[model samples]
Target: MATADPYGPVHTEGNAVPPLDPDLAGALDDLAGIHPGIDLIRDGIRHLALDRHTPDTTQTLLATLAGSSGADAITAIGHLIARLANADHNPALRGLPLDTQKQAQRHGEQAAFHLNDPTLHQPASEASAAITGT
Candidate 1:
């Protein structure tokens, strides 16, 4: 039988953090490595590609994740990184398809480059065009 989630819901401003999908997590881990700090870089990816948050969310989100949970929470972070990276920038191009895999890899590399200092609070938009190529 399926068990209930042990850590319960992860919330940021009442928004529940997305569940970790294994495929997404694997892709992210492949791109960003399995280091714990990889979790912090996720916010950068979100800001750069998805434009979901201010570039400064890294530390805040890291604190949120640190308090909310553990392995599962980190996994969720990795999943989000991969999901944003792998996202198709142009849905209309779905028929023909862009090299989204490459784009995702580019995003992952960009984020991982910042792994050394994820809390630096730099603007994440610098390489948005290069990473997403949109």
Candidate 2:
């Protein structure tokens, strides 16, 4: 007979959550190692998710991530940087007021600059390559 215990039902191996994508996980690890203020960035992500006050830099990066269609983390990040660098030239913002568009473009350029710092890019690229098996 099965015994009833005070604890809740036990989960078997079959019921466990699937493992994370290895490449994505590795890329995140690499980013953490290279980024100077990873903890702050994480906090910023959280704040943005929770609708709290987040810096424009954080918002721009997060928005890029949200809209990116790259096959891997590295490509996605690179694409985001590129997009931010050309923010003012994007056709999608044509409907917005010129001043508002300019402000957003400035924020995007600043975000790209910070993310493209050599200190972070080198390690992140190496990590991305490892994930892509290149």
Candidate 3:
């Protein structure tokens, strides 16, 4: 079924960490559920110190979320990360050559096309195909 690996390799060699999206989603879910001093997490993220801690910061956030009762917080985190992932301000992604970004976007779009199965939505397809006796 080739399920997507949400925490797969980050495209950097030899590092054993999952992608950033999972981490962000996990952290946000925990914070909102616990109602912790999310401001602190925000402050830490704003300072770019997260890069310094490498895996520690991410590990901690994920651990916190794991322990919290707000298990659904991961969904909230995804919402936050989707905003970041789509934002033009992130030079980390936007700095890439336009063609490179376009290629990645195309990959996503193509996957969506298959998953959506446009054939099912065809305007004038034979509705009896499901009951074909021919």
Per TM-score, the best of the predicted structures is: 2
Assess each prediction's global lDDT (C-alpha) against the native.
Answer: 0.47, 0.53, 0.46
Clashing residue pairs, backbone N/CA/C < 3 A, model 1:
none
Give the per-residue Cα lDDT of candidate 1 at 88.
57
**Residues 1-134, candidate 2, lDDT per residue (tens digit)?**
98786675646666454554577456555667455666565555444444433344443443344322233343455556557445356777778887877777777767665555555455544444444455
- In candidate 3, stretches whose alpha carbon ends up further than 4 angstroms from where it belongs are 1-92, 118-134
Q: Comparing candidate 1 with candidate 2, which one achieves the higher lDDT?
A: 2
Candidate 2 residue 17 Cα shift, in angstroms, is 13
TM-score on alpha carbons, each prediction: 0.23, 0.34, 0.23
Model 3, global lDDT: 0.46
lDDT of 3 by residue, 14-75 (tens): 55343457677566555663435576665555444335343444444443332222232343
- Model 1, 83-130: lDDT tens per residue? 556535434335543576666657764654444233332233223322
